[model samples]
Target: MASRWVLVAVSAAQLAAGAAGQVIALSEGRAFDIDVLGFRGSPARLGRDSWLLGTGLSAPVLMLSVQAVATIRLAAGSSRGATRVLGSLGALMTCGYLIEKEARGALSPAGWNPTTTPAVAAGLTLAVTMAVLGPRQASSSS
Candidate 1:
């Protein structure tokens, strides 16, 4: 029970982080682009496709929402397999993001922000750990 709640809390935090990033990207795209991606040009010059590609607002938010609901369902005694699958997906997404960032040199021209890489890595680790643990131990043994 306690473990399930912890998973829920972690999932909720992940959701919040992803959603907040999306919102920030949408509302103040120029700042987000500049701060996170190290873009120098104006937001207007970024264009629609560039903004969508750079911000990644859609897929990440959708994935995080799914993970949050799955974690909530797990806490509510839903199927362990379902929760595991969702958690795995969440973990994979985060890993992919981290890998891409690393491939790009993970550099922020504005200097490194602890909030960016560390937070995502923490979320990824948590999600992967939860997936590995599966549902509650008591339920799994039954």
Candidate 2:
């Protein structure tokens, strides 16, 4: 029961954070562009129509939504296997983000920042916890 609630809370947090990021990106494109793309130039000079940026932002939001739904299902007494699968998907999304940040040199100068590292950690933790818990199987009564 406690584990289920923990999963719910973590999933909700991820969903909220992902939504907030999208809102920020839409409302303040320049700032989002600089923080994410590591643009050294002025924010005002940054263009907003990059498909790469759209893809980058879309993936996490989608995964977070999926995780939230899975958490809800788990809370409703769904099988742990389903929840674990969704959790793994979320972790995979986080892994991709981590790799992207590394490849883009985002973590090179400042080490792990507050932006995506926490999300990656949370996702991985959730996945591991779910995996450890294992699937809830039906009882076979005689």
Candidate 3:
């Protein structure tokens, strides 16, 4: 597949995940999983449908890894400087994912927390990289 298209798809996907994360974070009537778990002790006991939706936000977090590597590889064909930027973005994205996952695990334990800003920033960086890198094309022979 064309590398430029890959970046586009990944960027769009990142944006989607970001939106989902915000939705999960803002959903009302949600409970702290530990409290809910201790009380109800079952998935049904989890309460708040949004808790289930919160887990879905990670889909884009994981996608950022694929986007970053693909962007890095595509950048390798152009400028080393651009490659570094792509690589850095990719690393940040991965770190964001790990950080969010860890934070969610640490804080919520029973489900996703959707409260990490770093993850959101990392996702934004990935989206920006797609724009920064622009479309890939064969070098002009001139």
How much lDDT does each candidate structure score?
0.50, 0.46, 0.43
Residue pairs whose backbone atoms clash in candidate 3: none
Ranking the candidates on TM-score from highest down gives 1, 2, 3
Off by over 4 Å in 3: 28-87, 101-142
Tell me the TM-score of each prediction against the true structure: 0.56, 0.51, 0.35
Q: Per-residue lDDT for 6-102 in model 2, tens only?
A: 6556556655645544454344442222335463323353234322232222234445566667767766874565456555655564554454433
Model 1 C-alpha lDDT versus the unseen true structure: 0.50
Q: Candidate 1, residues 71-107: lDDT per residue as tens digits? A: 6676677466555655576556555445443312323
Q: Model 3 Cα displacement at 127 (Å)?
A: 9.5
Worst 10 residues of 3 by lDDT: 133-142
Which candidate do you rate higher for TM-score, 2 or 3? 2
Model 1 clash pairs are none
Best by lDDT: 1
In terms of TM-score, the best-performing candidate is: 1
User: For candidate 1, what is the TM-score?
Assistant: 0.56
Give RMSD to native, each candidate: 6.2, 7.0, 12.1
